[model samples]
Target: MDATQHDADERFRGEVREWLEQNLTGRFAELRGRGGSGREHEDFEARLEWNRHMAAAGWTCVAWPVEHGGRGLSIAQQVIFHEEYARADAPARVNHLGEELLGPTLIAHGTAEQRARFLPPIVAVEELWCQGYSEPGAGSDLAAVSTRAQRVGDEWSITGQKVWTSLAQQADWCFVIARTEASSSRHRGLSYLLVPMDQPGVEVRPILQLTATSEFNEVFFDDARTDAALIVGGEGNGFKIAMATLGFERGVSTLAQQIAFRRELDAVIDSATRNGAIDDAVIRDRLVRARMTLEVIRQHALRTLGGEQGDGASVTKLLWSNWHRSLGELAMDVNGPASLLVGEEYALDDLQALFLFSRSDTIYGGSDEIQRNIIAERVLGLPREARP
Candidate 1:
């Protein structure tokens, strides 16, 4: 807040802009949907390539300390990095689970050996991880996680199922939450494990999103084995561990995502203008609304990160989720039937793809209703709604 801090923040922002301007050129601009960004998305190979590029550039896990293969960034520097990434229209880093979730948890709680063994490879993009939360029966009720892991002397035997695991099939590892001691209790009996996701006794059943191709899946554990040393935190601390990680997830996820949304908004405006659809007053009004929403989302994100906490601005996530859905709908409406087309036509011409992905943003992280409940109860001091 002092003059030195202000100067450092400005210098960091300027450095980030310079770095992106230097490295993010050529086809990457096309990748970020610059020629057009909302409907355009990278394929799996392009995504992995982008992650490697960012990782090598020391930009993958920008929040980590330098010794752990991060850039040793200040919070302001982190914001600057994201802003410049957005400004350059870079693709979202595909190693989000590694760079965001696993790395932070390791920083907070992992042992020296665990830190040394697990984090750097992730930072370097050698490893990819997925969240093994959200079981078939446990969606927002995270405490009801029934994936069981039993102690077998030196090793642990895991059995149960996790549904809606993002990138589960392709991930090298998973940060899994399971019920370890059921003394027949739910929340009090859980534990977290870092498991090799591709091992035997693991089944990955692809779950289709609205677009059709599977982006997530149900992962089953039939006597899946993991080492006892893989236990994250002490036993029965899984809920606490997972919740603590969600705080980091909410803010960081919003930062990365808001940038994406603003890009989408800009893309929408440009697409509308280019297509001659901006002549419609409805389209103009909608663009105006989108601009206002983007501003609010950005301000809310800053406030949430600035320490005014309440379920850590789950509302921000929920708002953007809904806002994006509307954006997709607007794109379709503005473009008429042509929005149904999906391809690599430069920028984000994959309107069909954006429309599809938008449908699920509300479901991931947490659903809109659940976020609203959290905001009401925790932020507004409201009473719970009883279900029949």
Candidate 2:
């Protein structure tokens, strides 16, 4: 960055820091105290309210284009905003799919009217969205999805069952990909559509996990109708369009998520310190590794915003997810059994929740194995394997 860039970035950071110091006290303090404190559902209403509050102040999607209800801050400003928010233990994000994935895809490929209709509500957190990509047979091999979309006059009637649909029960809308023309090659016949979940013939059933958390769901769409106008890109281009959406998901958004990791890192260090374990060689070695990993995250994700997203996004996602899991385990190793308690609001107990959540990181957004394949075939010119 040049002198002017440095000065302007610092000015924005200073402003954000001051505003947070002033208006970000009570709720943030409570969240910090609560840290991984309750049932995931218990935080839903409060999280939604906080999302709208931050959106109203242009703090929710601060990196979005100025035309799309954002501050149009430089990547550095956005990083500063995220770091401060994480340090303050700001409320958890509530509009993940909408603000992170769907809005950006619409901005890039949807018509002007589509952008006008969709992006604003996402940034405002007035609309919530879930993804309908993975199906009964298509988890990692997304192109193998057999869900059908039949065009009928001005509308496309969709019929499919999507499993592992996170937050689908709570989402007001979903971005679905189905086989528009099933006869062609597997990858050639797909198309993406934005469908409303509140309409008739749409059912969302919770899939409770071993942890007893209902974060995932099974969505059945029996003749769910979405207008042709809601299509994201041209027919038969859904696979390509879905790739673009995933790029946004794993690329620029990784920066904010890395900031979340930093917060967890601090919590670990704090616990280690209070236990007088900081002086131990073992704990200090882990702290050093954590700090170095943090720097790598900033350099690789936050600073690479100007480049084409490409397969590097997948690489970064896998890297961060693995790092998160490792950090959680490290916390437990340093802090002991007290760090593994469920819904524990007390210090050291939050690490338990963090560890539990880390197991899902490799699964969501695409698995680590899938990311490695992308990096190998797409970026490294490797040969493709045939499935039996």
Candidate 3:
């Protein structure tokens, strides 16, 4: 906020920009713009290598405290790093679920032993993580999760299914919220356990999407086990810890995501110009709206960073998800009739994949209806939605 702080922020931004420019070269040069939302399958090994490289360079968990194997970057510095990373077209991070979501949650609520054992692997990108929150019946309504975990001696054996798990096949661990108290219901009886995924008891089945990609999976835990001490917060307090993790989900990385969206929009604009779709007043107006909406999204994201994360997270999810879904539609319209066709075996082009994948934007993370309810109840002090 002060001039000295402003100068330091500029210097940090410069350092981030220089580092990306210098490192994103040679074999890594081709990896730019690879692996994101729908395109997570692209350059899988390459991106993993890149993530490890970042970890080695102390760029992986920039916001974590220095004692926790991080650079201890301030919020502004973290934003700058992410913005520069996106501006450089760096590969989508392979350890985002670990660094951004789980790491912060651990720092906030995990035991010191948990932090010591887990934070290092995450900082080094040695272990990847996937969230185990959604289930067949409880996607947005997290309180209804039925994945059960029973404590047996020094271990907790989990048994249930989780749907819509992103990158589960690639993840080494999953932070699961299971029903620990069978007699309790809703948000009351859940326990958050960190379960390993490499064991024989755990099964990950890829869920193929309309885009012909399988980034999401159905993960089934049949007596999958974790250490009894791996539970975050405490038993029956998982709902609180899970909510904290969700708050971290809407962190500084959203700024980088917006920059990537800007790149996508630029490509769409270039395509529309090449195809002379820009001549259509309607199409051109929509493109302009897309640009303006992206700016608004960035502003809202920045503003929300300084506020209460839970309430702001709902508004942030609503704003970006709907904007992105519309951007996908706009991409299709820009391509005109050619957007309908696919290559042999239904192979999708960038715009085609973008369009199809963005269809789930409003559905995943949190749905439009769910977000509105959160905004109404939590942000506006409204009555809770009546439950059945």
lDDT of each: 0.77, 0.79, 0.92
In the range 212-243, model 2's lDDT, one tens digit per residue, is 56778999999999888888888989999899
Off by over 4 Å in 2: 26-42, 273-284, 337-348
Clashing pairs in 2: none
Off by over 4 Å in 3: 306-308
Question: lDDT: which candidate is best?
Answer: 3
Give the Cα error of residue 230 in candidate 2, in Å. Answer: 0.7
lDDT of 3 by residue, 174-197 (tens): 999999998989999999999999
How close to the true structure is residue 203 of candidate 2, measured as C-alpha lDDT?
96
Question: What alpha-carbon RMSD in Å does predicted model 3 have with respect to the real structure?
Answer: 1.1
lDDT ranking of the models: 3, 2, 1
Task: Compose the digit string of candidate 1's lDDT tens values, residues 1-388.
Answer: 8999999889888887887887667756556642212222236667677678877877778778888878787766777777777767666667777877788888888888889999978988988888999987888778778888999988889999999887787789989999899574657988889898778889999876565557678999999988899988888898878876777676545675687777667777888999989999988999999889888988888766732233866877787889988998888887887775555632234566677678877877788888888888888889976752
Query: For model 2, what is the error of residue 73's alpha carbon versus the real structure, in angstroms, after optimal superposition?
Result: 2.1
TM-score of each: 0.88, 0.89, 0.98
Model with the higher lDDT, candidate 2 or 3: 3
Superposing every Cα of model 2 onto the true structure, what RMSD results?
Answer: 3.0
Candidate 3, residue 35: Cα displacement in angstroms equals: 0.2
Better of 2 and 3 by TM-score: 3
